[model samples]
Target chain A: MSLAASPAPAFTLYDYVLSGNCYKIRLAAALLGVPYDSIAVDFYPGFEHRSEAMLALNPAGTLPVMKTADGVVLTETNAMLAWLGLNHDPGGRWYPAADPVRGPRLVEAMSFGAGLTGSVGLARLHAMLDWPVDGAAARRAGKRDLRQLELRLTAMQIDGEDWLAGGTAPSMADLACFPYVALSPDAGLDHDGYPAIRSWLYRVRSLPGFVTMPGIHDLHELR
Target chain B: MSLAASPAPAFTLYDYVLSGNCYKIRLAAALLGVPYDSIAVDFYPGFEHRSEAMLALNPAGTLPVMKTADGVVLTETNAMLAWLGLNHDPGGRWYPAADPVRGPRLVEAMSFGAGLTGSVGLARLHAMLDWPVDGAAARRAGKRDLRQLELRLTAMQIDGEDWLAGGTAPSMADLACFPYVALSPDAGLDHDGYPAIRSWLYRVRSLPGFVTMPGIHDLHELR
Candidate 1:
């Protein structure tokens, strides 16, 4: 991790080891080589995140809070990733730093990242763990969302853009969407059905600084 | 609706009047004084957003597609709002174009706008209109979501940030969250329990350039 010439920032990440939502920040941190401590939040310990301290850090009560040396608390995975990519990178190239031409596209990708990726995440939550998701109904929703994903992937392919919202360089949008798309099949989605999307996923996975989401079993395997 | 310096842009907004999601962009346009042509998308036509044309504009079939004059289409309400607020505004005060300190907080507020306001939208969809949400278990799901919404509102009150993120000046985050939170009671949520959120709603409504969402009874209401 490159220490800022000014001073080392007291950085820490509050994360759950198995969470891809948390993993997004970890991956960005690794890619950027930013040093930070990690504190695990036990979600299963009866809503431990609902505790007062966690709430103070994040009223949303979600994981992946990155505390800066100056004492600012950052929440929301994408928001944190955007900051690290924008603020820490020496090259200013991790994510497009807001171009007049492509800025809007970046935001579109993020909206899909949050909404579409969120749908896939919930579908998997129901599929694997038998959470509160309605059985067949959840799959129906997944199928619908998958169609949207396919169309989005196709448009990027058709738009002939090398990467999402920027050519040749990877942006935070790519990082934001990559994981959920990579694990689409776990939610009953078939990548074979969306060839362009499959290609896009491979492209994201092959990035020079890429990191995979803790290998699925890391949650059970790590500890 | 200010005229462009040259020919007008090819802007198309796939919007529903009562939707806070679409309102995000419209609010930005009003603040920036940009004229955009509105195309009413029928949500009741079995998720008309799933149509091929809409998908071509946005793979996720989301609303508020602001296509530029040169054929570049921008989706994602917040991103579109940010782009216009930054690029089109001469003063660039709407988004505070270059202040890194305030940017992330605004982005965080935008994310919270999505999930938090989205829950309110869901409540309206399920409780008020009694729409058959594709997930068959959605009825029960709605109540659970409402409980979560109450908690979120309570936390927002506790945080007590002046304008959703920080500072007295409002940004896209406040605009993004306005419609759904304002109309949440129409969906059966009692804001009487969340005094702070209730006040926040009024604060958003009081913004200088804010425009009310069109009435359903009016011909141009959906625009």
Candidate 2:
């Protein structure tokens, strides 16, 4: 389960250890058993992601920039997730982009995950790193978003659906959303108010090959 | 190219005539020649999109909700575009979600387009409908986004690619981004400074079945 560098990996990820977005790629690669090389960047104190070299790789100056062995660069986290799912998973369950019903739903959940980035993600950055964002506004938005997510998760639970896109197996949608929602406590938004989200987070962590990030830990061995 | 109601349309689109997000759906349907019934919701002044009825359909309270005849509802515009492209377009050029290379790029551009909804789209809403957003901040972000788009478009043009995802034909990426960038003038961001964006807009408008919204117009008959 170790992500130690392979002699020759398929992808190279420019990652930040504390970033949920970056952890998403790492966790997805781990769960799918896809090997990749990781080059750590200091996003907080160093702001290396915004440096000229990083910007050359990803003009958006975002973390979790992924480059394939063939020189294809992916700057968006969801896009990177899609690429990993579509290319690596032999069973095609991870992406399922060709499934007419599930594909759009997957895309929908992925977009919702990006919304979480602006809300919970921003609030976390502000709280942890004192990033120059409107912390109060971000927390407000994050609370609203978490509430909405809880409602959806409750509905899905009622419908007997275990995944966000209502598929038998978790897709990129789950991977896209898992990190931020799992890390919401760092933003001062605790899971006590979101039972369904807590359950979903537990299920995600219980998955085989699940990896841990700074704020989110792997499930206890006894559990 | 007329979008007049069919006796039995395959889908129903909850629409707002002036909304750039809604236009993204209408334009995608038109480009793919997919027939749909339009249910207009008064977004401005009325805020019908937030009304109880629309809330029952889309809790997100966003315009451009699409329901398939089979009763599948798509709340995200990019997801709706993906559904239309994946389901309607026989050639599959519009989605290309199965392509290892193009699929990721398409998702990346689509994500970028959603960012436009925050920047250019918010600024436009502030200017046109006085939506009570931070017009100044929205404008600043809009300018930055437009500049980034221009740089990418310039690079694409240099590489002899006509579309956003670097595909031979336009994909959902192009449609997802076309509306906001085309409507940037409403936000006080003109195309005079971005030659590459201007050309890309022209190319998009020149597509065979391009439709027009309030702020965007079709090419003249002579053209």
Candidate 3:
């Protein structure tokens, strides 16, 4: 049945199976019960995304572009999350539409997650693959980022809330951060020094419909 | 005296007089006419953000924390903009509540804006002060970022849109990138190569209630 005839727009995700960034959008869609089709982009082979067809979808050359039946394509996980929260979850649990108070905190987390978490993830991925970056440099950068991550995580605990921010329910802040925060060790950074971060990771992972990032190879299995 | 008595909550912004980051928030508040109080933080002599009192306001130790009437402290420029757009401007102008189609494109602009712009800003500041960074190395980085930014601007030109993304009116994407985009000359980068960016800067600079950054000295003017 065409979603156009129905009340909601049909959803489709142009994604790479293992990307944490892609997973963030997919998890949100699944939790919201928004039916979406996933089309794979083989980043390793540089196949689909570089083709002229994919370029037409997103010029930024990134994965996980979400297409809506209304002929709209949503890219960028954080922005997509914001749109989904506003449109789908009217009650505002996934996103607090009314809470201007929590807005900056959530935005900071998402920005930090996208940047710092990304830096750490890259260093870790290079280490896992024994790539070009020297082991010592990778570890040093990982530790530096972890220290900052710990500072933010400690703040989360001091706020005395179960989630990263002070909301009774976890908003995008918690979701934006925890995925990579938990996986930092896999990238060769130690999390033992940050117990609060470890606990927060556990809390997020324990959430219903929580899907782990498929390792670099097992992406197909998860999808 | 309080906004609790009214429908919309009163907005207040805690700012450091000289920080460009803080300027983005103030600019947003001014354009929205949300009526905010500006609380100033002293960034002189040493890093004021590391101070205990400041930490209490924002654990991340960043400025431009917005306190809503209900007393919630919103941190980060992009996040605060998102909240304000959703809460105050239902008109879909400053923050565009309904344009999911352009969501990802806007996020990409903002992300590129935050990271690349911040880096270029720092490089310029360092160059202006005759700081220690290798000139060639820094220029290489600045140029790399400029290439990415140029591509984005070119694409915006193709969309035949004046703003970065979503809605006929400019939103956070434009504001988020405007500060550094306008100041590219300071980084020894040339904007003459990018016609759309030049036009976009004019558009942003002409916004109602637009305020310039307090430079590197008078950041406390808001106080």
Report the number of the highest-lDDT candidate: 2
lDDT of 3 by residue, B140-174 (tens): 66667777667766766777777877446788888
Provide the lDDT at B152 for model 3.
65
Per-residue CA lDDT of model 2 for A1-223, tens digit only, reads: 9886645687999999999899989999999998888899988798899999998888889898999989888889998998998788888888988788888988999999988999999999999989999999999999998999899999888878989878668988999899999898999999998989989998899899998987886689427
List clash counts for every candidate, in order: 0, 0, 5
Q: Poorest 10 consecutive residues of model 2 chain A by lDDT?
A: A214-223
Please rank every candidate by lDDT, starting with the best.
2, 3, 1
Chain A TM value for model 1:
0.83
**Which candidate's DockQ is highest?**
2
RMSD from true fold, candidate 1: 5.8
Q: Residue B185 CA error for candidate 1 (Å)? A: 2.4
TM-score versus the correct structure, for each prediction: 0.80, 0.95, 0.77
lDDT of 1 by residue, B114-219 (tens): 7754555676776656766643344334445445445655665566655755666776767766666666666665567666665666666656666776421222
Give the per-residue lDDT of model 2 (tens digit) for B27-54: 9888888888999999988989999999
Recovery fraction of native interface contacts for candidate 2: 0.81
Candidate 3 overall Cα lDDT vs. reference? 0.67
* CA error at residue B91 for candidate 3, angstroms: 6.3
Writing each residue's lDDT as its tens digit, candidate 1 over A6-89 gives 436447888876566787787777777787788888865456677898988776687778887667788777778767866778
